[model samples]
Target: MRDTDLSVELCGIRLRTPFVLAAGVLGTTAALLERVARRGAGAVTAKSCSVRPRRGHPNPTVLPWEGGLINAVGLANPGAAAMVGILADARRRLAPLGVPLIASVFAEEAGGFGEVVRILEEAEPDLYEVNISCPNVAEELGMPFAADPVQAARATAAVRAATRRPVIVKLSPNVADICAVGRAVVDAGADALAAINTLGPGMLIDIRARTPVLANRMGGLSGPAVRPVAVRCVYELSRAVPVPIIGMGGVTTGEDAVEMIMAGATAVGVGSAFYQRGMGALEAMAAEMRAFMQEQGFGCVSEMRGLAHGA
Candidate 1:
């Protein structure tokens, strides 16, 4: 066995590995969350839920492109109140595995964010990831809250006030200045941040039928295609803010996670990778990270954080 340690601490929460099962990937149930935890995920985030249930987009919601995947799943969920049972069960399942359950919440308005948080507090999640960045819901919600510093802060502050859990604000890459948003959320009471929620609200056309592949027409691009952007956002945020960051985008391999860490991410989020590499990807990634660390003569994962920032 390699002597390298993959454990990481994010906002006082100790993670056995830096690999977090990013929100939205089979995150709707306690069974799914527990499955990922048993498979080696250090932490798992539940799907983003709102005050009320969402129908979400219809068929062809996700598609794989040459680079990665493009998705417009909309923010469909069972809603905060409905998810309490699932989240509570998930927390129970994950607790035995020594994994933390992160509940992600969103809303149509700033105050709605707190209302959702309050409803879901019964689950007692280890952390709350305020998803102010989902691009798929822009059409319904009117320009994602993450696109504006004021809106992002408002949403974050609402969540902070509703729960004592660590609030990790999820930011969008479609913004003009992610660092500004990062700073805003931090000042408003974010305990940590998750960057680059997806690149563009891009679209794909099915030339044969002359129609869009996704039912929603446009969706956020993710996977390897957006990894570079994710790294840049985390790098800038680490410099601009004084809180931990969860960097995610196109991260599929152990080396990818290591790169994210070097870019200043305290933890790396893995979502599309599960679809691309299966649930086993987490264990594989952790192994890959350990091998890389050993080969590079590093003793722990923290040693790789922000190495890219050095001259």
Candidate 2:
């Protein structure tokens, strides 16, 4: 019989496992999302979508680094209306796999975010991830939303009021006190918090051309290099807020996911690793997690949560 103990509950939704595909990467398309679900992710969050379609940044949007990838994909998407149709199809396909889909959405302002949330609310997504940070995008509103606690609170509160679904605020790691911002959002009614979106305003320069590697000049940093910071953010925010936390940064293995969970994340999101290992990576990681659990004699992932804190 299958080990049913891998299940985890996030934002009021039950997942078959604690593994979830982070927004962006291969999760943008319905076919790719279905492929990821079949490969064994407990849930999948679509690439961040906005009210209007965005072409995203120009080529050389992603650059490889020592332990991760720096990307300025600029939140490229076909807009919310088109995304709803795509999500509906993906949901139907995922039903057989019993994997939940969380829709990630972003907007330029509180009003815009509310409208986007309201529009997508009818799509019946398992959850809604309010992206308050996107370093690659050329918008003045994205990161600014979470730069301060008051703004973060207002934006999250607006989205919360617009939908009955769970609202998860995806934070930017570039902030000084992420916990303060996290607390604001949670108080604003966010059902959960997704910390450490990407670390940056970071840039890489080509020594030969003496120019920035990415056309956008600067992008969000993600991967193994940022894992430590991700852990700290998750740990601090988990203590400051009562909502569940989804930790993500450089998680590439079951051990990495376990670290985040132990640091206080109920679930973990994998992105750069997916690009590095492809869709099959999800299954590989899940298998590793099962083995780790069995070896440790833990029956469920919940039992492993925040063990670092002696909880």
Model 2 alpha-carbon miss at residue 68, Å = 0.7
Compose the digit string of candidate 2's lDDT tens values, residues 95-153.
88889988998888777888888888777888889988777664544456777888888
**Candidate closest to the true structure, highest lDDT:** 1
lDDT of 2: 0.86
What RMSD does model 1 have? 1.0
Lowest lDDT block of 10, candidate 2: 135-144
What stretches of model 1 exceed 4 Å from their correct place? none
Cα RMSD to the true fold for all candidates: 1.0, 1.8
TM per candidate comes to: 0.98, 0.96
What's the true lDDT of residue 151 in model 2?
81
TM-score of 2: 0.96
What are the clashing pairs of model 1? 223-250
Q: What lDDT score is found at residue 229 in candidate 2?
A: 92
